[model samples]
Target: MKLRTCPRLQPLKESIRFLTRKPAQFSDGSRICKRTFAGHTTAQQACDALVYNRHGHYDDVLQLEKVLLPPVGDEDLRIKMLAAPVNPADINMLQGTYAILPPFPAVGGNEGLGEVLEVGSKVCDAKPGDWVIPVDAGFGTWRMEVVCKATDVIPVAKDIPLLSAATLGVNPCTAYRMLKDFGNLKPGDTVIQNGANSAVGQAVIQIAAGMGLSTINIIRDRPNLKELKDKLKSLGASLVITEEALQKPEVTNLFKDIRRPKLALNCVGGHSAGNLLAHMEYGSTMVTYGGMAKKPVPVPAKALIFKDINVCGFWMTQWKRNNMHDLSEIKAMVAELAEMVRRGQLSVPTCTQVPFPDYKVALDATTRAYSSKHVLMME
Candidate 1:
């Protein structure tokens, strides 16, 4: 039987022949074909396309390359990433030192704000066009899109800026868990924390204040200590003092008039932790989250034995996975904090937003900025 080809089929055959002979034409024509095809078809029918990737580390630069989009599974949700913060953990991931190590040629970014472009058949809670924040750590949030388990993505407030939502997974959650779970904080109680100028620390201050708990913040000596102290105090800190002042004998009497703090949050280990512990009352608990100095915390035997001081550690990822109650509390706290930010009651501090175009410069700035304060990277 002889098959007759239509006039439209003739041109398609010619174009295919031309593309077969000169593959470069195929590359050039693919975009036009893709656009036309996309206009005619729905997203579910289209194949996954290339996005972004980091191949390896060359000097300080993350060797980024464009690659094919990842295939989504039945339980996965495909997200179009809008913003991801360049947090300290992201830098650590690049250095191959972070606790969570993603596979090589992997994307790096822990927290990101994204829109669900598509979800597999089994994905019930997520839907296309829903703005969501990734709940999992080190899920390659740096890329323009990602495929993750639907359970790993959580819906976020639409009114919140994508930048703010991008940072929702880590610091704020850490602060919430540390304050509520480890501290067992009650209304009208007081909490003390070193690294009080950190993002987590600042969140703790705001959350504690909003929860009717006062804060005693300890920060390093900065040129603008007075201004920093005043700013922290404005954020519901009952008192703000330098680490040097914490070592002074007068610290005991300092909180005599104020509510004695039952909980102390320590991010800075070593001698700094000892100073924070000294300020805590008998039977008070101190939770160490991060060791920024990379030094071990030295708890005085007297405080542990005689004063009944409890020294504990908090890792937000592990805590969230292990304790459902703690996770629920964290979600509630984030909602409360988001409301506060909306109401202009909680401030995120002055952050320098770096555009994606200037990411390298911003990364360097973030490294240096860590010396003084937390540097928030906005993508």
Candidate 2:
């Protein structure tokens, strides 16, 4: 297919889609047209290039166009995205259900891992070839490349798996913050969490185990509970129980040797929240981070007053913004997690990579796979 052009789109044509080639096959059977750089020979000549948003409604899937790089001033670095993960939040944002909204015609992606292709003269901390992740929450990350203030990118180890790094930012951060902030767990303390098979839940189990804390993980009964329990236990969970089991008196009796949990993490609301709260001891806290059931957290006031229990909410973006100084520390924790992956001490559940051309099919498959493990789309 011949490349099409418009009279008013000169800068876009010059910067982004200059060296267009025929769409080629990807490993997953998707096809993507390759883009080439021209004009500037050195990194200095490289302009910001991206999958531009021409126009669309909130319900529409983003129609990406190859456009010229946007203008960059002082203190900016141009980054080429390697991969971006598709999270439930990203889906919610596309559907306009998220609290934060991006401007129209903006690229759509929350988290990605990229390599710096050029750096502003004033940028002292980062340079070309450094692998980095975004520090800003809502900045568009779906494009092939972007230009942003140097301070917005957090440098990461180049050796880390780029796909894993792309998937790390939001969910893992949520898990880490919720456990550390609300739970105040000590080495021998036990904590209970619902949605134990979720990305954040899995992270909680792993991180809690790594910190010498035991996890009483509760998951909804699936067709294959044995497989699920075995998987979670391998990640260091002390025990994996079903929501139905919580209703049984014998299950609570089994925990007589362990302290009444001081913390409970609830992402699934509705009756699940009540079920999770039942396992917590008096004077403890329950942190609700999400409502996957699309229902309000229903906890008996008696549990609060009589038991002295506290319930709170968590949003990672807000935490990061207010606690910017803790970012370096958070990054160090992630790096340590990465090292654990290298040493076979930690592992994420298996994910299937779908091709970009099969996005529609992939998206449907992803929605269905939500009950299983994570689904990743790659070009």
Candidate 3:
């Protein structure tokens, strides 16, 4: 048998040797460096980053520092951050309230999109100009640039909307997993969720809609309630009701058009969660992923004894930890979600883009407006 060889194969092995060769050094051992791809110099670089020296109020502790980054090494990629979101979790992390906290003096963001400006030797999976996102949390993405091991990030298609790619790592993944994991869900199956206007909730609505499932979205009553309801409905929500409406007797009348929800996603907790449980079908599951209300979930005795409602909690960080060894499923989910974005099935939530240096404004906006999503753009 004869082995066929492709004529298009580049001399990668030789290039690897050249790329990975040690930097030249003088007699005294000081190194000589050269500028390479995308104007990256083979020397230590200084970049501006948002660092928190100690866990406390973000306003008090978070500082903008000129941090020195080491040169890219073999199997590493130098990423120029494009954008990162001012997620609630990032705030919580800075305040020492989140479940996972990085070491002191850590950078702020865990999710963002970056452009790989330079790749080190042996970095076959990613190359200059490819867009990438942190594969898991604690990536410290709130920086101008980063030198990270290729394994720490995953390449994503550059064709997706910039904001969509920037915010893709967490919220949409959470929504996608909860919808698929909790329910033996099928097209036309009904799912209900609280926090309907939340980033995750909006993602749930869109992903469920794409999967042919219907959503009974419940949000807290707001001043612009009508506008909010219309917005959710436009995102493919089968029904949009207020949390107060969930308690009203007339709410049941809406169920006449669709079956009771088989799955419930609880983000607000407390009364809002109770409302979701009250509307769930018998033997249905409710997955709690957030406690924005900072209140305990109340479960009625009848719900457990009569309805057999199964309650569980989902933490995206924990899920990633459990599946870190084999990320095929995670990768597949990301691919599907990206395709959805390309097809217009998934859209970036309402966002206020603030320049990276104006992170304070973005943080303040995020803390003040629960419904608004703020992103920090490097440019």
Highest-scoring model, lDDT:
3
Pairs with steric clashes in candidate 3: none
- Candidate 3 lDDT over 1-379, as tens digits, reads 1111212111112112223322332111112122122344333576778876567887898877665566677777888999999888889888777766654446788899999988999888777999998876767888888877777777777899899988887999999999889978989899999888999999999999998999999887778989988889999999988777789898889889998999999988898898888889999999999998999999999999999999999988778767766667777878888999999999867888999999999888878745499999998
Q: Rate the local accuracy (lDDT) of all candidates.
A: 0.65, 0.67, 0.79
TM-score of each: 0.79, 0.81, 0.87
Q: Candidate 2 versus the native: TM-score?
A: 0.81
Candidate 2 weakest lDDT stretch, 10 residues: 4-13
Which tens-of-lDDT digit does each residue in 1-379 have in candidate 2?
1221211111112122233423331111112233443332333333222222322332365544443453454677887777665566766666556765444334556777778988888888887999888765655665566677666668877665666677667777787778788867789998898999988899888878887888999998888889989999989999899989988989877588777789999989999998878878889999998898889988898998999999999987666656554467757756776676666555644555544433444345445534443333433
Order the candidate numbers by TM-score, best to worst: 3, 2, 1
Give the worst 10-residue stretch by lDDT in candidate 1. Answer: 6-15
Q: Is candidate 2 or candidate 3 better by lDDT?
A: 3
Residue range 1-379, candidate 1, lDDT tens digits:
1122211111111112223232111111111124234354434333222212222342344634333343567877777777766677677666666665544334556666788888899988778998887655645565555566676656777776555666666787888777768657789889989999888888889878878888899999978889888888888788898989888887778777777789999998989998888778789999988888789999889999999999988877665545433345545656765777777666754555655545565466556644432222323
Off by over 4 Å in 1: 1-61, 72-74, 323-334, 369-379
Candidate that beats the other on TM-score, 1 or 3, i.e. the better one: 3
User: In candidate 2, which residue ranges exceed 4 Å CA deviation?
Assistant: 1-59, 325-330, 369-379
Location of the lowest summed lDDT over 10 successive residues in candidate 3: 3-12
Candidate 3's TM-score reads 0.87
